[model samples]
Target chain A: MVKQKGILYDSTMCVGCGECYSACKKQNKLPETNSDFLKDHLSANTYTVVEQHGDLYARKMCMHCAEPTCASVCPVKAFEKTKEGAVIYDAEKCIGCRYCMQACPHQIPRYEWSQVSPRVRKCVLCQNRISKGLPTACSEACPTGATICGDLDDLKIEAKKRLSEGSDKYYQHIYGLDEAGGGSVLILASVPFEKLGYTPNLPKQPMPQLTNRVMEKIPTVATVGGLFLGSMYWLTKRKNEIAREEKEAKFKRNEVK
Target chain B: MKNSNASKLSFWKIVAAVIMICGLYSSYIRFTKGLGASTHLSDSIPWGLWIGFDFLGVGLAAAGFTIAVMVHVFNIHKFEPIVRPAILTAYIGYTLVVLLLIIDLGRPQNFWHPLVMWNLHSVMFEITWCVICYSAILTLEFAPVVLEKYNLTAPIKILRKISIPVVILGVIFSTLHQSSFGSLYLIVPGRLYPLWYSTLLPVNFYISCIAAGLSMIIFESYLNARAFNLGLRLDILSGLAKIVLYVLIIGFLVRITDMIITGKTPFLFLPRTETYMFYAEVIVGTFIPVYLLSQAKYRKSRMWLYVISIFTLSGFVLNRINVAVTGLVASSKTSYFPSFDEISITMMLVVLGMWAFKLVSTKFPVFVELENLKEEKLPEDSREMILSE
Candidate 1:
């Protein structure tokens, strides 16, 4: 079995260079929107953005969750978590209900709302290149050793090593290590994640686990509820029939008398 | 009387025709120009007016199953008079829902994919199947009405024999789907505001819809009375209103209790737009109607009953909209307001439903008087004899 690949992004080492951003756009074949790169956030045309928060810079992209809420909520199985740890999308299977957009905890998936036939746009962690034994475009293009791509298990050890060695400067946490149930991509920031525009207070448990608790009961409810209702109908109808029969018998006896 | 009826119908027909034309044109533009040009939806907010309207349509049409359970499974014969109309409204409402969904889907042609592609984990998947099943059930429940009009005794007899089971299945399907609508929001706790989000959201949806469904039935009763000149059955209408009152109280209690338990009660006091909308929804839609309908005099009076029903119905609409829209505003970077085309299409759908209801009621024996004629033709005692066997 192939080991699951992952990315470790150390925000303290990032230099706010546009190389990763340009590499992402080039690799994805996305058109330029002519918007200011610094002022712009992620959109249909931009898969990766290097956002500057004060003096520290953080790169925003898909979290590639181990148990993605988007994949769970899609009715048609449009999203899949590949063996290599990348969460890929199949536009062919999507009916565009946009439940994935709503269900995503990170809100990373962007839609091509402008096109006649729109598909959800998001970072796939360069699954295509990874499958061909190459590093991700963004990670390869990084000049500083800010972003590294390798096996997820190794990345976790590396993240812990950095956190312990530089405990003074670091926030004493890996942002995506257990956030939203542990995504493949992990981040180490100097400041708190919320200050860097990352959503805070995400539950440690997987987001899909919350909804699955309710969804798992659907079959039982349907079957048991159906049986109960069926029996109630039968019992009620029988009781009504017995009452009518008694009334009919009483009327006949009265007539005969 | 004939002239007046003709004038009223013609006026509505003109209005429906005009709206339908505009709607068809808008749909043409939508299909040709794409959702980007035609709708206000964006990547940040993919669901907008159409989704909110879909929720409204399903919530209002909830009467189909509620009335079925009341008259058939529970054997509440007094409500039998309104059952056919309620089912008809649901059939129409569901048909409109399906239509709107097709238009809203990015790939409308692939709408049938849900049947073959099974994702049991998804609440949407469950809802899709339930909707298809319940729509069929609605057809089966309402078929006898059309069959009775043609005096098709054989199918009518068969349908009557199996009516109990059919109604039971309908109720089961409705319960699952109605609650599952709230389940759609469950995965979005981070996005949806705390004031509306809760683990018991499905229960809240199921409870509120019961009241909304009952309110719809009452509102329809008054409209049928005026339109068909069938004098309003104040007895039946008041009985329904009384039930609505109890349901409203239950819904209110569940919501408030859930809020307090979840510690969301304090958020209700926050001077925010969502908080204000929540207050409006609870106050205008729930509390006022509950208070007025609780009074015996108000329940007995036709005008007061209608007013209360309207408030309750609008409250249901507001609640659905707030859940779909207002609750997500804070988290979403982009603010959404439906474009003119979106609003017109929704209006067109409502008008189409009204027209369809009018056409069906006028052509078929929908009223109680006509149903009495059929009952007289086949005596109740003989039907009971057939049933017992």
Candidate 2:
């Protein structure tokens, strides 16, 4: 029903300023994490973070994958990639299996570890902000326009343009372009993505694609297999039992004689 | 029925109730205190002793399906005496698995949600349904024993008439879910180490279950001999071991083929802890037992047969843990290790399951034939009388 696309972030243009992190926290109403070493709330409550790597700073959040592992494995249908390309979570439907936590390749989803009934917390791409014709909290807060939000095709064009002209600075690869089946959130980084904490070895094909193929066999295996096996067991046992009965009857007749 | 002392049952029942109460308390803590506080599970290692023991309980309990297949399907008259007791063991073991699952679920209350709102795509969802249906099938298949114990001959006859269909269905369901348990991890291909990953995981699981199930029956028969003071039935044990050895040979060969086809042969040759463990399972669990059982002299030796049973069980446990936990070594966020509380809770469930089994066997006609007991006892008594003269 609703069409979906997302932002492509060029990490090379990003300044190490905490503007996006603060804006996201403010927008989401997340509490500030008071870790002694790390003052950023993005580790827990803030949905996205800006990590400082040497002279460059990378913007990190949910990749909004086309075939999300979280959505596939969530025993309860909690984590959903909405038609509009936002990977959203509903706390009400959450079973707290943390299967989403286990399934996620990027490890983007965070849980309230201390709570008895914890919910998975992650980015929804500031859907409320975008509905009001404004960019995401981090995108609006950015001074250099490093974080660009738009349609998928538009972002791809932008990414390719930057890759071709800015070869001296760019890594030639467009991270998340084909990774995990073309996620809504794309990243164009100057350095190797491994340094920025991206899963470099992840298969380009979506995680869900692999499992969906495997799961398609469940109906046949569970129902049809059950029936066939059950029937064979029935016939064999009945045949033997009847033979045993006949033998016993003959033994009784002989004894009577 | 021979041990129909009400006082004895009541005494044991009280002990059982106390143990169950403690397990319930641990379970309550598991739910209320969060997994971090209740068990040794961590983000890196979400599964622990409960999963391992679940595999152990299921593998050991394979006796039920194997014995059922032998007595009913294959019409193996020699193993008929073992069929009822084997079914009872299976019933007990499955009940334990259900209990362990509850303990492991982060939200146990939401467990029924899968049934209420089905997830047809989820292998775990399918397994949940299969186990439930199969357990019911087993109950129906085993009902004649309970009816006969109560002297309900008419109902027992009716049950016997329909038992063929029920048992066939149960076997099929058992096979499906047994393999589906392995397919459950197919979702984590990227996370699961290549050493253990195989598109043929479901097939591998089913084969191992068959081998484990047969060996378990052999092991249980030995336990019965010791417990009941019935001298070991070397003939039956050896016969059963021969079957286990056959199944293991097929299963091992399949595994080797799978590894080779998947190009994971390099992993087996390469030095790694998981690879080494895999080798140990293949060698000690399947190969050694196969070789020993192949020899007429070794198969006849009671001590050697017992040793093979232990090896088979260890191998079974290792294979299951590899599928459930060890396979996910690459994706593990932290070092996965079982915690102390997890071990205790796991032990608590096992002890309870065993105690329940003991109570049922003593009170019910689980071991239906006392002819073997009588036949053996008469010889010793007569020999003593002649010696005194």
Clashes of each: 0, 3
Off by over 4 Å in 1: A238-257, B1-14, B368-389
Give the per-residue lDDT digits (tens) of candidate 1, residues B1-389: 99997999799789878888988888988888888888998777888999999898899999999988977876766677788888998999999999999999987878888899888888989899999999999999999889988999999899988888899889989999999999999988888989889998898899888889889989988877766556666777888888898999998898889889888888978999999999999998888998898788998888899999999998998899999999998899779999878988898999989879989998987775534433233231221222323
lDDT values for all models:
0.87, 0.74
Cα lDDT tens digits for candidate 1, A81-157? 99999999999889889898888888889887777788889999999988877889999999997998998999999
Question: Comparing to the true complex, what docking class would candidate 1 get?
Answer: medium
Task: Return the TM-score for candidate 1, rounded to 2 decimals.
Answer: 0.94
Candidate 2's TM-score reads 0.86
Judging by lDDT against the true structure, name the best candidate. Answer: 1
RMSD of each: 3.5, 6.0
Tens-digit lDDT string for candidate 2 (B317-372): 88888766776765665666776557657767877777777677777787765425
Alpha-carbon interface RMSD of model 1? 1.7
In candidate 2 chain A, what residue range of length 10 has the lowest lDDT sum? A35-44
